[model samples]
Target: MIIFIDSYTEEKLANSLAGRPGYFKLFYDTENCGCNGVLAIEILDQPLDTDIRISVKNFTFLVDKQQESLFDDALKLEADRSYPSFKVSSDSALYSTNVRIKDARDMASK
Candidate 1:
């Protein structure tokens, strides 16, 4: 599968990832939500060894193997200027319009 991230989206993500030792996670949050789950971009400081990595242009995304089938072969990550979040979509469907960025870094220690 191929993931596309535009310049604007890259810049926005870079600003948050700058100097931070973390990995981008394309997470399918199903723990909270019912029948359908929500798609979110998570910045995790430590990723699980079982996580599958999806390489894009200048970055990589870690996703659960079980949830890998939820995405299409091609995907796009875009920036949402209206809010401090992002949007994940593809030609086949609009996954999430208001996809949130969850930074799992320890902010208290830093």
Candidate 2:
């Protein structure tokens, strides 16, 4: 699976973990954080037992089990100069890059 990380995000992650040793936890979860439906990215000092650690582009991602199905095959996360966040896309029609981040209240409508 090819997960593309933007230069900005990459630099940010590197800067965050430059001095710090050990593995930096990158949390990916499908939760309603705001109005739009989007994935959540969190940096943790430690890793959880249920976390799935994937190393891509010299960066580690801590994905949840429930979200693994969405990334079964080779998924790519492309990032450009304009885009600051990671863009996830897969060859499978079951999953799409059209995912939007939604808040708790917005999720209730769906």
Candidate 3:
């Protein structure tokens, strides 16, 4: 799947990374949500061997090879500078309107 990140949202993400080595991940967070978990955008420093790369303008997002089917092939990501969450959608339906941004850079890498 391809995700188009808006210019403003991209700027915020870049600032969050702070020039540190990292990549974005379309995370399917199943923690407390349920079997049908909420989606999130995660920033991480480690490159995983199980990732399927989806390239954007200046960055590439990684998705778990097994969970690639959870998203639409073409999607748009948007966010308001005032809020910390994001909205992900496609032509067919709105997947999630308040997808959280989870910065996992501080967690121990696998």
Q: Write the per-residue lDDT of candidate 2 for residues 1-110, one digit (tens) a residue.
A: 34556677567556645555334332344356653334545555555688777887777766666556656556655443453444555565433333322222222357
- Tell me the whole-model lDDT of each prediction, alpha carbons only: 0.82, 0.52, 0.82
Taking all chains together, the TM-score of candidate 3 against the true structure is 0.87
Whole-model alpha-carbon lDDT for candidate 3: 0.82
Error of 2 at 102 (Å): 16
Which regions of candidate 2 fall more than 4 Å away from where they truly are? 1-9, 15-37, 93-110
Clashes of each: 0, 9, 0
Minimum summed lDDT over a 10-residue window in model 3 is located at 101-110
Evaluation by TM-score, superior candidate among 1 and 2: 1
Residue 66 shift from truth in candidate 2, angstroms: 2.5
Q: Provide the TM-score for each candidate, comma-separated.
A: 0.86, 0.55, 0.87
What global local distance difference test value does model 1 have?
0.82
Residue by residue across 1-110, what tens digits does model 1's lDDT show? 67899898988888878777678989778886885777888888766787888877677788887778888989888999878888888898899889888787775578
